[model samples]
Target: MERLINLNSKKSLTNEQRQAIYQRLLQESSNGKLRKGSISDIANSYAVCTKTISRIWGRGKLHVNEESMVDVSLKKSKSVGRKKKQINLGEVKGLPFHRRSNICSIANSIGVSKSTLHRRVQEGALRTHTNAVKPDLTEANKMARLEFCFSKINRSLSNNDSTFDDMFNVVHIDEKWFYLTKSSRRYYLVPGEDEPLRTCKSKKFITKFMFLAAVARPRFDASGNEIFSGKIGIFPFTTLEPAKRSSKNRVAGTLETKPILSVTKEVTRTWLIEKVLPAIRAKWPQGHTGPIFIQQDNAKPHININDSRFLEEASRDGFDIRLCFQPPNSPDLNVLDLGFFRAIQSLQEQESLGTIDELISAVQVSFERMGSRELNNVFLTLQMCMKEILKVRGGNNYQTPHIGKGKLERQGNLPLQIDIDENLINEVGSYLGL
Candidate 1:
């Protein structure tokens, strides 16, 4: 017989306790006796706090019966048929602009139609164009960029006898979104998966905040211990403006709710004057000032790029920080942007946050919960990207060598090297290397 404990809250059970209950259930079944207590009774007794035991007990074996197995097979067949219909609908609509593949192509791939694909895209699905054309890179500009790249590489080699790491001291900086919902609610486990599993809704649209952060290679102290020190800058997605425009014509008219615009350059100017400058002075009272290198992307009129408030403050304080923009349209280079956004989406969905204040709090909590290990993963991704660039820009060893140096180097060599890495290469490989 087992005794139940009163739960202070609706907190879920830990894995160990659940496992214990499973052991106890097995013992009861093997004995062929009426269990002293019900599954929930045993769960509460062992402090598992889950109704899963009761569910498993009532459901008996999970193995499907013959009739039910056939039913499920038929259901899947019907689902496939419905999917075909949906794909036909998409082919009709997409006929005007896009050249969609046949229904067989769609079904065999994911059993999804063009309409479903479009809806998923509209819903912010991470879909990619399989046959998208490469962006045009003129020969001249390509040559220049190649020369610059080689110059940088040579300068790196000349500066020190450092390995590949020396050539790429890239610090990727970007913002990410995080929601306030509990992580459990945000992510779902398909069951029987590996540890450290991720939740799905982490990529979904949720009310989340942006975090500006910079991830550098993990450093080590003089004692040979690794120090995972990275910079974290907070940018809460809360509104300052209370009044929001309801309609196009009502920009200056009646408002629905006061809207707090994002912390753009304008907001940073005000924030620095009021809160940031004083905080900086108070934190570094020794008056430390020097040139700081910051890597960031081009956000909507970034303060570091357009506004002089931060620069002026840094200058006044004797700290000259240069904010270098990452390559255009390259979010993969910005680790924090990816991490922060995932965090934002996860927390917001988990907490099911309603109000703006609640959302901000959730984002703050999510960032705090995120540790340096996760940050290191982001940095590693950036390193891999640099390695890939070096590989493609290499001489003859690369798979699809991007001939010439940079944009400028391409001027004299193009038309010849223009379609060097064209889509037709795999389709028609002339130089069949073993």
Candidate 2:
């Protein structure tokens, strides 16, 4: 006989803890029974009472005659924990969209804690959805989108497999604004470290510069060596001007970067003639001297590129670079909008840039830092989206498909293009009255 387990000290032992205690009891035992005070010794080691240890030992002994392995599964009733709060989904869904916009609001409406509602969401009992406003498409827009998808399908291919054109000659161009800093940023800081403070003149007035990015599909040689990186150029809309007045940061007469407030047709045309076309000429592969098509959205600046000014300049340098517009409101058709711009923007945001020049440099660096494989994947994703659009009869209301591009690439089996069903193409054409 030894000291008794303190009744005041008690805990609900887990199945693992009970099994551990039973093993300890057997170790302290001789032939068949636990030694004197072994129950108290094991219970005190596990921070449980003597009765809890005894119950575990009893369970282990009951299985001794029948089986060597003891089942230490918990015997507590299912009703031991707190009951799930009753949720009337009808009452919850009846709330206005704005009223139940967040977990807290929905929880209050259903008379539960925020954690309970969040738990329900995690357990799939409740779901969170996000809806974004889509561009209003008319009959013409849908037909145009359908026709565009039909055009991408390689009609020249001999097989019945509905594969998209390799699009090696097509370059995607899009305009996006690069801000100096994000409004809110998350940072991981060590405990007792002071939180960072970042301020600007105003968020609306934060230094931002627009860029026109152009990328073509990356090409690989027989050995998979990268031939052309497909990065044409990321041109910043800024003009260099000498500083009129001296500032604490810079001396007077220093050429300061002045961002172009508005990029009109003239500005876009100038970039094409001066910046974009030249970069394309220099970077385009010499062996494959084909007519490169510049695919762009139907923005006002991009419209009317058939004019002599654009055609005259584009036809220069022994390269025939033609301008073509994707269907209106069909961003999925363009590789840039499908995901590339966001990818480079995310990369650009990682840097701490201050001046307009620095921001421009960061954007260009990010554009270059992107591997050719990612750009190629975006093109494949563009084809996948076109396939999805055809499935929905040219509507943009389709989830983007995910084929494990990285996994496939790791296995050295990434396709240059995605193939679709031949029937989908015919059905889309019939739906569009083509």
Candidate 3:
């Protein structure tokens, strides 16, 4: 029937003329093909019946060749709907709470419109605060630190009557501890991994650590800095894995196991006496005249200043080993504690070592790979910290010179042992802005 209609409709027209008429009709209806434009308008313009145009261009049904029917839904939408124009605003400057002004100021400063700024504020966009200026370390503090280090260095040389130029004769001593696991409360397991799998329990795994280490200052390179320095003395600690027991849970067929681990002060004392002292003696054979210092914490084991065996060992060697006790509980004052831990944590995160041997190897490699320069940087940072401390509390004899608690006690509640005079407190308070 369509073929008969087409033939009758083209009876007065040549094939080329008929094709041209059909193409002209298609061109007029092409725009309406994708949008809300009227098919009636297309039919009137192309001299075709509305019914014919509707039949050919029904929804998604077209008489046109497949190649010519490109999707123009987007173009149609843009042509019919209204659009917004963008404007340029200048740079914004002030904070919200401080300025307490309308969004227009921010919009002008930020090169955006007030509407945009208000919309962001409504959406909880926060303004950044400008930080106040900070004061540098005072000159008095700097000079005091310079004098402290130089005085110690000089006193060391004078006591021995050695040439002030011989830096090797001065042995700097420090001790550090390393923890096996990170000291954080949180632990995560991968999805689908079974919990409480067959693994060594940290407590029952005989987590006895390798010995504490003591190193002497290394000979300086031509650059006047310490090189691959110091002898390491490991005083292995004696810790024991206690028994493990499983407990029945109230829930049917459920059980939990807890392992017991234990350590003793005797173990520590013996390690220091039998291992550490002997190691120091072997390292510095020269009597007190020899360059040796057992610089360490005032810990009962290391300092053991009154221990007959430890003192005898030092005195016999003619090495006037000094037990320089830092203010108690001030781990921040000891760079090795913080810096070494940071390095250890960084190295451990990249690799997981399962066995004790592997972990030990990892630790040793981490320590060895950390260049002397890095160690010196740690020390330099420590030096700066020490200077800062002295600048704040130089030459003052507080009844309690050491601060064991994490925070300082209030002036009124502070014990007389603190020995903080009213004048000094006022001065220091002003220095710290109370």
Candidate 4:
């Protein structure tokens, strides 16, 4: 007889345990002169109810072997329980477009609960995406983008399989307006902690400063140590003037800095000559003695390439630098616009600033705090975007490609240049009538 265990315990018996009990009962019955209460006696010894033993014996009798022992199936039948509810995806999709905007609305239309629709979303039957307005590209813009990408290909080594040139000689410059603070901010706090309060005269009239940022591709030696970080500088569009009247914060004749709200051709030219050139001259890698291209967007306020003052200053200091314009309506082609500006903006927004000086300092510090590897990755992304543009025949309708940069960098397999498909290049060239 088996040892007696707790019958009131919540734990259920396994199939093997139940089978052993049945076999023992059958063996006892075979010994002859079975008692009238033999089933109850066995159930009491096994710590199971009499009804459970009776059911097991009933199932055992249905599948008796040659030796008169039960050999019943352990697994339950598939058709024994209730079936799962089925959802008609076609009916759900056929609902009005506005009605299918959210789970609650869609579920109500389909006569299902929101939780069921949420489960489908979790299972990838539905996806959530944020749409933004993309620039409308004309035929000329598309062809220009294609030509720009083609110019970056390094075909001197091998014409069959061309690769992109290392963009160390190219500097990406752009202007971005950094605001004092966002209207809405999110924060995490302890249960009993007080919420942070911030105020502004008007959200629409928040203090903002426009800054011009310039960056080049970082250089590394054979040992993988960065020799030149390629951070030229970030200059703010602000000017200082003395206070003409007494105020609570300051007295008359006190020098106060104010942002230059309107940027013009003259302002752009002045900063490029005074601030941008000097910084590039100071930070330019000594080993690299080649012409540098300062790439900018086709903004009207930007200085023209043929500006005599810029050309004159650019040719000085033993540096061959020139200004070039990227394709219009294509912000993805610029490294700064691709991701660097947003990275620095996120860091800058973390600081508290009450004055223009503090804002400028915060932005400059954030720009310097950014890692060179991140900037390098943005440059790589620019190349990948170029490849995508070529693939789509210069149409910006494709998603950005993720090449697992982190994993590749960890394995020391991160490539300096991405190779362009020869067939793609030829096909794009033929399509462009080049």
Candidate 5:
């Protein structure tokens, strides 16, 4: 069926559409005039009268004769939209956070129109940010964070720009809890489809499992080939035991995988000595030789970096695998906490989990499913955060810097190491009395 275009009503052609028409007319023209019915054909295709097409062709030809760009844009001025209302950001900043917490409150405080402020927000001129309260840093914590970031820099000056290490040998380990289901979840459903109904013993008693994740900076060869994935493994804190008594869900003597409700220093040490150590030694890049560092946070349940048991297992098979602690109260310093854990958690949430076994499998699948490139990006972000840590003299008050790692990777130009300024190094070093 042939569709109809309303000719009486005004039709607005975008700049690209007008330019396309002009180029078509130029192609079909013999000298100045179009081929016999070229105008009619183009008009019918665009659903515009021949007159509109002729007018455009005339203006385009005039530009061709004058050797200028086609003036196909509407004659209307660019200032066609409503005049934007401007608010003094300085004044807004001066107001207390509570006063400018919402658009209505901000407008009332600054005496600006609420609708205008909302429009600005909608246009992204202004943003509504929800900032969680950051962990308070004591003077001691600041110094520790500064020293940790400083240790990351390679003082050898091997390159023109002194940069942080590639971190290929350092494995960042962290613990996270994955619940069977979120207290609240979002789902897309077909029209008239019934929403999913979920029941739980209690939201507080939701099935949860703790996991220890270990990841190193992924390795890439000279030609950008993947040498190592950097994914050592993610270990779940679980125990397989037989059900002592018969239950509605399971028969007696059936094997059940249960989560260890509480994580302790002893259990964590056991995992490091038994699971984490073996996985690292087996998966460590064959050609790469170095004192591999297992960087972990200073949690209460974590064993000391020099734990005798950990050292005993880590030193096997000519490998100098060692444990080290990142700065306390600083999650950004660890690559897993910086981004990898969050990435895997989001993927885990997408799976339908009903049992503890399902949760463990889901978390494991999410861990293995993540690409090495993403893990490398997290390590790069870790270096960028270190730079920010030094900038604030060890304060965690700045936003994480994004250097378009994905975009750079797609362009085959992702950086292996982020450079640090010498002045910044000296300034921070002197402050730390190093």
Candidate 6:
């Protein structure tokens, strides 16, 4: 019968085929006599290519027994495949910055394949970063940030043992807008399941409500049991208005709640007096009686410290709540803006809401549902960022600090405060001509 030939010329021979060819060649050599076309005969019989048989026959000539033939018939060595191509990262780095913006462009400029560059990236030879635009910092802004970090240090400690205060007396307050629905969402579905259908009037015109959130560092008793959670309250800026005409969803003259689209000084003052101050009074721990500072950003619409309405309610119930502004254009100084708002926003986005009221309720729920431990960690992160600001001499060019907060918490060794470098502080002081 005619034997079938391997269609792929580059296919390597298996161990069994290699051994069979070796045995046949050994038999032909042992008799000290051979047919006129023995090598080609064996190649046609085994359906292997002639080139592979010639190479195996050469190796079989070195073996004298079946054991030697078996050893010689093993698979190819590790280095048998194609050689790996190397890209000179140093050469790539010499290119203009704009030319190295993407993998395809960089690969072309550096004379390397994009797939090889991608593999190098997966192997961590190259790194990818997302750049964000930071607010410009004036000289005055830098000085203010420096002073703020200095103020948090416990100067009462000996010059050698200075550390940051626990920040228990400071309450961070900020305003954020919560939308009723996101333009797009991702959901996991079973095979053959229908995709979720969502419709909206316009992506940009989705209904959103503004909220004022207040939080403080949580307090714990001697046993580490939480006595007072940091969450003071979250109040929405909204109002109820009567519908003028009958609609498909509601009858005429029905009171419909709507978000206050434009939050002005008057609205902010009202919420502080009516909602914020009351919540703080009711939730403030009884044992601690020191004055509390409500820290906010310097926005034009925010109420000033001397606002008549806020001053009246702030001093009542034996509580001294004072309003203080963080450094101008410095959102990083506020704990809420630094990370808390983003965390709660992620949680809020998980829920589905239809009306302005439902959106408000969802945000409030997310705020309350956040754990005290997370709030405390964010406060710690804020303090760490302040240290970074000081290190950079007030410039916002430092990397975010990450000291394994989760691992620390698991080991029950999470610190309530971070220590500031005394030498760094003195250097900053001299830099500012203090």
Q: What C-alpha lDDT values do all the predictions have?
A: 0.45, 0.85, 0.44, 0.86, 0.86, 0.83
Better of 3 and 4 by lDDT: 4
Clash pairs (backbone) in predicted model 5: none
How well is each residue in 1-434 modelled by candidate 3, as lDDT tens digits? 54344434632323444344445545655444533456555544555455554544442244334545522221233355544433332223344444435566656555676676665555656444445333243556444433443333222223333111222333333344344544343447899977643344564433324435554433444545554444444333433343354345234333322211232345544555566556666665333354344444445545444656555655654445444444444444444563654674467445555544455556666655565545444454444444344445543211212342223222323221112233433444465454
Per candidate, the number of residue pairs that clash is 49, 0, 17, 0, 0, 0
Better of 3 and 4 by TM-score: 4
Model 1 residue runs over 4 Å out of place are 1-218, 222-228, 237-259, 262-264, 271-290, 304-308, 338-340, 343-349, 394-434
TM-score of each: 0.44, 0.86, 0.41, 0.81, 0.82, 0.80
lDDT string for model 6 (119-236, tens) is: 9989988888777779999999888888887777785456876678889998888999888888878899999999989999899898888889999999887777998898999988
> How displaced is residue 336 in candidate 6, in Å?
1.1
The lowest-lDDT stretch of 10 consecutive residues in candidate 6 is 1-10
Minimum summed lDDT over a 10-residue window in model 3 is located at 412-421
Model 4 scores worst on lDDT over the 10 consecutive residues at: 1-10
lDDT per residue as tens, model 5, 76-172: 7889887777878788789897886789988988888888888888987777888877779998999999988898898754545898988877888
Q: Regarding lDDT, does 1 or 2 come out ahead?
A: 2
User: What shift in Å separates residue 130 of candidate 2 from its native position after superposition?
Assistant: 3.5
State the displacement of the C-alpha of residue 229, model 5, in Å, after optimal TM-score superposition: 0.9
TM-score of 6: 0.80
lDDT of 3: 0.44
Q: What are the per-residue Cα lDDT tens digits for candidate 1 across 355-388?
A: 6567666666665566554455455444444334
Rank the candidate models, highest TM-score first. Answer: 2, 5, 4, 6, 1, 3
lDDT of candidate 4 over 1-434, digit per residue (tens):
33234445434457887888777767767533345787878777667767677777767766653456565434565476666456788998799777877899989898988888898888878777665678999999998999999888887456776888889899999999999888999999999999999999999899999999999999888777999898999999999899999999999999999899999999999999999999999999897776899999999999889899999999997889999999999999998989999999999998988888899999999999999988888888999999999998888998978898888888988889988888887888798787
Q: Say which prediction, candidate 1 or candidate 6, comes out ahead on TM-score.
A: 6
How much is 149 displaced in model 2, in angstroms?
1.0
> Which candidate model has the greater lDDT, 2 or 5?
5
